[model samples]
Target: MTADRLQPVLAGVMLALVGFASSFAVVLAGLQAVGATSEQAASGLLALLIAQAVGVIWLSRRHRIPLVLAWSTPGAALLVSSGAVEGGWRAAVGAFLVVGALILLTALWPRLGDLIAAIPTPIAQAMLAGVLLSICVEPVRVLLDRPFLVAPILVVWVVLLRVAPKLAVPGAFVATLVVITGYLVDHGAPDLSLAPQVVWTEPTLNWQAVVGLAVPLYVVTMASQNVPGVAVLATFGYRVPWRESMTVTGLGTAAGAMAGGHAVNLAAITAAMAASPESHPDRDRRWIAAYTSGWAYLVLAAVSTALVGVVSAAPHGLVEVVAGLALLGTLGGALKGATESETGREAAVVTFVVAASGVAFGGVGAAFWALLAGLVVHGVLKLGRPSAPRM
Candidate 1:
């Protein structure tokens, strides 16, 4: 292949690896938090990878755009903090199905899309920034808790950020690998099979799970994942067909739920990697990067069991530190977006504080509450003022 083709391919692979290495542990922890066993968690990872691979390939081809798909990281974090649901993992799967159906319905109905779009951009960004705030602090916490193990990673990440900003997180990831390898060598490799497994669980929908998991999952996936995903594509001049992409991802989420995975949607950070001009000089050819990433996800799926084992074996807080480092840039961007406008500044700050508070009511997570609080504050403050004329 010519260099033109090879560059996109390389970019695709880089994005895939970065995406996987950064958050696979969070995915596992989220599954376990919702009551999944080790076997079930592996299956969930496999299912998510396969579903996203299909979605990415199909959407990239259909739209002829570098449309990347990902399982919702914020949703997973919500799950992690959601505690166990009433019906256990089955109910969680049911919630996943419900979330997927909602996304699909939104895609099929323009009104639903409009309703979500009606959410103020600053509020959404604030909520996302808040959701990410906890995890983004892990590197610092880890540094204080296990300085010997984490200091090198921070040093490498900082050095790369100053000299090669694009590779900063990837460098931290490399440092993590080195640290993990040493620890594993000292403690003995985990006994894990190389082959991937698929464990199917029946869905059980309960009001508790639906209200708690489903609603929050849908809101965060839409506000934090899909919205920013579209923005990333738009940043590179790609006009996203939002509805079609939602439909594909929603379907993928539903399919993955049967195998224990959570919601899959348009990717935000990784999508930028694939859609960026650096992926391909010819804008029209960047779709190749997404396609390549899809295939790479499939390859990762084939080794899902081993990947889970490696992450699962790592010391407590280590994986989170790496994830925190990987997401630092995203957190920075979200914060900037959240506070950029003076009109919504107060509402945005309210949203950020509420979300970061991690308050849960009626089993629902803080992200939903944050958005609600922001909207209320925004509305009340704007009550006596003239509404900005609708465009």
Candidate 2:
């Protein structure tokens, strides 16, 4: 391949690793939080990553577009919260399948697609802000618990993000590794033996799980994860096929869920690296970067169980702080974009507030609720408004 082509491939690999490094722990914790044995969770995430790799490869190769897929970060948070309430991987799997079916239906049904499209962007933004708010909280809490280890790393991160544009996330990752290593040696961290082996779990599909878990999983993944993901692509001037992307994401999530992973979808943060000019000057070449990143994700997932134990040996607060700080930019941008419009601002705020309220009505998550509320408010506001001027 020419040097032009080679650059994106390399960039994608690096970006993908950074993306995984930031959020992989949350994925592990989500599974463990929801009653997955460390073994089952690892297997499931490996499955998710493998499926994601396949999807990313096929999609990028076929479309020649920079399409990157991964487990849903928002869905991970939802899994962490609802998994705690729902009990067992069975429920989580059922939810995953339901979400997949819904996405498939969205692809199949033009009317539903239009309806989903009708949702104002601001409301979607509001819900996104709400869903992300919870993730931001954990790192702050961790910082409070372990200031010595996390604070300096956070300082380095903020300064780097401001001072060195390209190196922000990667710099944070390096800083985290150094701090974690020092802490481990200084504190005499335990020697944990974890084998990087696959442990498959038999999937059980139940009505309660389907209704309670699956549908909600689909809603949250689509509403919270997929929507902004597409927006990011559009914002970056890539006219990617949304339906096709959703299909890949749906299938990937289904495959992952069957293997005990929560819900895999398009990655927002990782996508940024590939999408941004930092990855490569030519936008077309970024697809190679995304493809390489998918390969790396598969490798990491394959070894996730063993790696989890090794990583867990580090001071927990350090990882949390780094991940959070790395995400601060993305979160701030999402918040701003979600509230930029006058017409949709109020509904968006409602969406954010309702979603952030953490109320689960009829098995749906905060993302769905936020969007739902925002839609209703937006509609009411529209009807209440004087008619638009004729051209």
| TM-score for each of the candidates | 0.90, 0.83
Reference-based lDDT, each prediction: 0.86, 0.69
Off by over 4 Å in 2: 1-5, 81-83, 186-194, 202-217, 223-244, 267-269, 272-286, 314-319, 360-368, 389-391
In angstroms, the error of model 1 at 226 is 2.2
lDDT of 1 by residue, 1-391 (tens): 8887799999999889888877776788779889998889999999999999999999898889999999888788777657688788999999999998999998888687677778888888888788778878888898898998899999998998899887787788778878888999999988877789899999999888998788868887887888888898998999888788888888999999989999899998899988888899899999999999999999989988976777678788887787677667767888998998998889999999998888877766677788889999999988967877998
By TM-score, the best candidate is 1
Model 2 alpha-carbon miss at residue 202, Å: 4.5
